[model samples]
Target: MKSSKLSIKFRITFWYTLVFSLILALVFFYIYFLSKSYSVHDLQEELKDESADILENLYDKSSRNDILYNADWTKFYDDNVSISLYDKNSSFINGVLPEHFPDKVPFINNKVRQIKSDKNIWLVYDYCYEESPEDSIWVRSIASYGHWSRILYNMLWIFAVLFPITVFISAFVGYHILKKALQPIYTISDMAKEISFSVNLSKRIETSNTHDEFSYLADAFNSMIAKLEKSFEKEKQFTSDAAHELRTPISVIQSHCEYCLDELKLTDSVREEIEIIYKKTTYIGQLISQLLTISRTDKHSFKPQKEEVDLTLLIESVIEELQQKAAYKNISLLFEYIPQNESYIIQGDTMLLMRMIYNLIENAINYGINGGCVWINLIKNQENTDIIIKDNGIGIEKEHLDKIWNRFYRVDKSRSAGEGFGLGLSMVRFIVDIHGGSIAVKSKPGYGTTFTVSL
Candidate 1:
């Protein structure tokens, strides 16, 4: 029942008002009690002094019969003072005023008496003087109390009239100020909501005047978007390049098949044509397999069984496997292993690393001049391992050096006739990326190109 009746703001305000009102009521009650006690004390003291004067006057006259008992003595007393004078015999001289008074007047303790006729409640205390044994005085005064109901009646009006006005002004100003403070966040949220895969992510979040945490968040988000946009562009380029490369092999096979199907004679030239068709078909199949490997590598589907591999042993085996090919081209396959350590043990997938090395050497062999040098070096830095493949080949231009690692990007279109798919460096880059390594190339028009893989 309590939960259903109140809201959060109302409950908070209600509790606050309750606490405030309680404190205010307590303070007022304390003051009221204090003032009431002080008034009673003063009234009793005044009544005692008046009784002394009355007794002294009666003694000086030495006659009680001549004194008027009914004459008003109120002018001699304060407003709170009440007096009931008694003789030594305990008989009231004022003709038994207010019988509700205690029969035996209390000396120290106060007593309460309610008079129905006067509608008054008296706090009564008695005083006796030893010097005047003939007279005793009983003093009673009206005591006031704080009425909680009357106080609450006034407080209710104050709260009802003032609370809504105050809260309304506060919430009104708070809403506008909070909205302005969060304006940048709203703008960024709107922009992010509209962002799609097709959206140009070159746009960035707006920065505010303050250099605070929100600004830092905006900067970091922009950096993430930049990286995503670059990755998307790379993927699109890879798809286009793979399609073109696959089409070449498929078209060649189709053309040769069509030509052979139109032939009739079993001549030598016809046999040669048939052989060419077979070679094209075989090359097409090889291209298709290579294309699959590249696609799988790009998609991170080629999971390798990794082991600790000795770099020196791996390089030696690769050189041995490529020795005949190098010899056929008359290219010098120079191996430079300049490490004081016996073997460089690295954790990696051995087969993929071997394929990457082979591809790099094959690219050099295909492009390197006859009798030129292709240097393969393994160097170690402070915290990393480096593999440098430098070839004195038909070098790439400065403009093309940055793009050599992109798939199907060839420097010379005529030279594409060689069994190069232009995906070797791209595959090498992917392999390095998976290993948490980096690769770079440096080349000029006439000089040779150097590809450095740092792990």
Candidate 2:
């Protein structure tokens, strides 16, 4: 298949890739946040511990009068940590006071304690200790809240670099993998497209590789194509044979008519010749009519004007109708309707179905031996309606049994050429197919032939 025709494959891959990327983004986001939170908390705790020791040393220095008292005390603080000191008078002593601190010293001022500045996300720890009986010092450390902001800042670069890179790589690999996987399907589709109505059916899908669903599909499609090719070939042959058969009688009639017209004397012999021409014309008309019926049957238009037909009555009527033909042929047509069940009310086109039976009977009478018996048994079982026509005539060969149902195919070429149009069994098969029934013929040369029809 062409890549354009496999748009469904791309659609599925797009959705899958989209979902996978979403999940990847979510996972990376979760890891970023977790790492930022943990790193920020640990860093803050470590800074606090180091800053507390520095404040202790500063207080000792102040007590010993080792430096100027009015110097900028905030200068002693590290840049990574903030510091604030309050005197015992509850006044600002060193570093900058929180801009929005409450006027009154809160309960947290008594000992080393942590507090949050609402105006900004700052962590503040306050420490207070008695320097002397009337003097005390207070220290507070402050820093920015750690995890969330750091993660946001870092992920900007990561996303900017990763998304396009991942998409390019994924698209390249997905295309090649999908193409390899669908190669067998492409082969089968190409073969199917090449199939034409007039094809000889020598080409079939290649199945030399592995076995899978595509192999099964190829086998099934090839089987159907084979059946259709065979059927079409049979149709072509039937038409050719039918035309050839009808031409002979038409030529005879034309010749006879021309001869009668050329006669100078309008005598008894001329009248006899005209009668022969008339009979030949009538026979040609009947052949044409039968051929039309067979054509309609092939087109599935042999719709019987249906009625609730009784099996026993229908068979008796058909036998009575064909009794004269059988008598003239010196053949015995016996019908035995064994009603295995009382409910034998079948729904079908009675007239067409009767014609189906009539064709079979006439065929037997024309082909069977003098004084030969044709046994027709109708059995209405629990499941189906069975009609069997068995004749003990010159039975067909094993090879011809399969071809006998095909149009214009004859077992005895010489005999079939003389009598009917060679479409009786073909019409029978066509009618049975339209009625959703099956027909099987069994024959043994020099023994007999039996046609079993089940509906």
Error of 1 at 179 (Å): 17
Candidates in order have lDDT scores of 0.66, 0.69
Per-candidate TM equals 0.44, 0.44
Per-residue lDDT of model 1, residues 340-407, tens digit only: 75567788999889978888887877787779889999998888889889988777767677787787
> Candidate 2, residues 379-442: lDDT per residue as tens digits?
8766789889988777777777778777667768322622676778877886676667888888
TM-score attained by model 2: 0.44
Q: Clashing residue pairs in candidate 2, if any?
A: 1-186, 304-349
Q: What is the lDDT of candidate 2?
A: 0.69
